[model samples]
Target: MVLATPVYCKYYSKSVPYEPVRLQKTNLRFYLHDILSGPNPTAVPIVRPNQFGALVAIDDPLTEGPEITSKKIGNARGMYILASQGTDLTLVLYVDLGFTTGEFNGSSLSVLSRNPILENPREMAVVGGRGRFRQASGFITVKTQYLNTTTGDAVLEYNVEVVHP
Candidate 1:
């Protein structure tokens, strides 16, 4: 009188309704200007009371091209914290990139990942998003296009690939 054989499969379809959705891939390339030392720095350090770690908040500009003079597109707004306990310039970053022009206007994508600053090209995961990029999942690769350690300014080239419905 025992007929229990994997109850999960029996009700799996009932509990989770299947809906047909079409996902599209979007590729975007932009540049971020991280100015850490200038008078109008885009990235600033947060002095914590405990002062045990390092954290920098950023509202950096996103441009259509790698150069600073390129047409402004949007902003990469978020924060990056020191991830490594040692001398490795690694960072845990969280950012929301919002577009201001073109077809992607009003849409945004979010990313949370570890950034190895010393690496030539760093890869990061795009967790989620809103607007046109709802339920987004993808990755972004960044390369330091230009950097001035003296002024603490950097221009990073970002290539993003995202899939969304």
Candidate 2:
């Protein structure tokens, strides 16, 4: 239900006033398995389809590779809004990604951005984080590696670089 909260919600985290004593940058490549058609789909449309203001809630698996059978290292959960009014497909995305089995085991990142979903490789902003990634800052580039129109399933490749403390 956190996704229901507005991006500009009244509740907020005051900015970190000081710089981290040491900053570390972590680069990772992963994939998101978006199953939007099966009986128990991970991503589902919550609003009128293909229309402006439409919303989609996502609880997709983040894997080590494009294959769904690959190692499941993390999870991506959030929502995106179809913000475009014309033919272009643009969305305002908000996601919280967390790793479960890798070096980033307990860390998580908060992301927010507006991107053209159809773009080959779209970038998003990393706003903050928790655990080892506290006070994080960076960007993530994503691409739709594979999509099954008939079943509404997709495999998305993600390249993330985060400077954190």
Q: How far is candidate 2 from the true structure (C-alpha RMSD, Å)?
A: 7.8
Give the clashing pairs for model 1.
none
Q: Quote each prediction's TM-score.
A: 0.85, 0.84
lDDT of 1: 0.88
Error of 1 at 160 (Å): 0.4
Identify the runs in model 2 with alpha carbons over 4 angstroms from their true place.
1-20
Q: Report, for every candidate in turn, its global Cα lDDT versus the true structure.
A: 0.88, 0.89
Name the weakest run of 10 consecutive residues (lDDT summed) in model 1.
6-15
Candidate 2's residue-wise lDDT over 1-165, tens digit each?
Answer: 355754655765787678548778999899989898868899999997647998989999999989989999989999989899987889898999988987889999899998788888999899998898888999999999998878868898999999986
Evaluated against the true structure, the overall lDDT of model 2 is 0.89
Q: What is the per-residue lDDT of model 1 for residues 17-93, given as tens digits with 9 covering 90 to 100?
A: 78979999999889999998857899998854343357889999999888778999999999988877676778899
Candidate 1 off by > 4 Å: 1-16, 48-52
Candidate 2, TM-score vs. the true structure? 0.84
